[model samples]
Target: MAPPGDSDSSGKKSVVVTALDGVINVNALFTIAIFVGLSLASPGQRSLNSKESCQPGILTVKQLVIFEVLSFSFFLFSSLVAQAIKLSLNLLSSEELAHGFSVVVNEKILKAGMLMTAISSVMGCLFLMISMLNVIEIKTGMLFCGAKSTIISVTFLIVLVVSGLLVYISAAWYAFTHARVHFHRQRTGL
Candidate 1:
């Protein structure tokens, strides 16, 4: 037969285990949202002319490459941070259970995830803006006459603005979904 306190102790442990599982699941969902936002906003389609071959006044492929590298590095770093938070929460939950203590029900984890998502979204927007500017600059440089240059610049500007709006809408949708999940968890006491 088990000791008097063992059964109650095991029951409490199971509750803690369940709560930890909930937290981990929530964190994973948030991470997935960030990845999806990055993919949507990435500049994979914009390739610049080679630096050596590009005209003296035009944007070069080398510059575009540098920008892409920087954007990717930021995305990677944000991802790592998100993963670290998830791991930390998991570890904390485990420690609490082992010590026979209850974990706090604060929304800190959810807020951290939301902040990370917002940062990633903004980074994605910045990359998109840079790419759009490069495109406009190249188009303007290729036009020979002043009037033609102005027309090309205006046209590219309109296109870029429309595209940027679309990207924002998509990012907003992802964030809304994430927030909904977090709210659901809070409501359910999970």
Candidate 2:
């Protein structure tokens, strides 16, 4: 059997699936980049440095940051796994092993990976939003110094929150819809 996109008559792969894969790829790449950026910009254990020197809620900020990092780490892992599965599927396009046990197994694995990725992405988004809120609280509670910096930081946090939400929704919707479409096609040979 030909791969999903190889022949139009096969109808094995819907456009939604293809578009979902593309969106997943883009979001996965962006998430990896965010992780790298966060790692590089991490302030380390500075929050623990002398309570007198730190803000009142510095401890909470530290905890939120840790939580955000962990959630994003899980999201990154899931996204990578999903992307790797998609890559493997693409690599096998030229092979003649399309209608075997392996094909069905791989398809199932891909769907599972996508589902996990969607879940993880949503969790990451929630964690990140909490982290952003913590940052906002910390900023607002600070003295009247660095107002410009606070504004800039708040703007950046809002942007991140909005973008993360968009990614989460898109990823989840794509994963679920693609899975349903795949199931329907398989059942009815559409």
Candidate 3:
């Protein structure tokens, strides 16, 4: 009998590698966006004191800076974690290096790391959204008092909802596809 991952014909390794690569890519992209966000927020925040902030439900420059910084920090942490996971995966997945080193990535640790990265990425996105809202408020006007501001805010919300649904559907499709294949194999006693 073959041990786990001994079956060279299986697609699990490729899928995992692909996922790892995707995570790394996403972290890098988020990091770049975080830097851009900081640049945008910092100037506005520095120019205005708390007393001068626009009133009545509008976000301040300080708030935008805070959210952007939080997003930046989360993305930075996620990038570091993803890099570590990538390094471990490279070592473990390689035939020559797999035995040369005493280090082994525990499955639980790997799962935890993945979960951490996923959560961090999501949090970073949430923070970015808040920052964007603040940005639009500042860039447009205060009090949601203008037609441009109203339209921009409403359109942004609509786009966010649509994109979220798209992501959910895509993830569900992938998950159910895998489950369906597993069910077929079990039913056939493979």
| Number of the predicted model whose lDDT against the real structure is largest | 3
Minimal lDDT window, size 10, model 1: 181-190
The sequence of per-residue lDDT tens digits that candidate 1 reaches over residues 1-190 is: 3335544544543543454354345434544444443343333333233332233242333444445555555555555655565555466445334343444434565556546644664564455445544444343332233345545665776687568657866865665465432111111121
Q: What C-alpha lDDT values do all the predictions have?
A: 0.46, 0.54, 0.60
Candidate closer to the true structure by TM-score (higher is better), 1 or 3: 3
TM-scores for every candidate against the unseen true structure: 0.41, 0.54, 0.67
Prediction RMSDs, each to the true structure: 10.6, 6.7, 7.3
Q: What is the per-residue lDDT of model 3 for residues 97-121, given as tens digits with 9 covering 90 to 100?
A: 4343433346566667766776777
Best candidate per TM-score, number? 3
Q: How many residue pairs clash in each candidate at the backbone level?
A: 0, 0, 0
The residue ranges of model 1 lying beyond 4 angstroms of the native Cα positions read 1-59, 94-99, 105-110, 132-190
User: lDDT per residue, candidate 2, 97-131, as tens digits?
Assistant: 44342333245666677677666766766666555
Error of 1 at 184 (Å): 14
Q: In model 3, which runs have C-alpha deviations exceeding 4 angstroms?
A: 1-11, 42-59, 98-105, 157-162, 165-190
How do the candidates rank by TM-score, highest first? 3, 2, 1
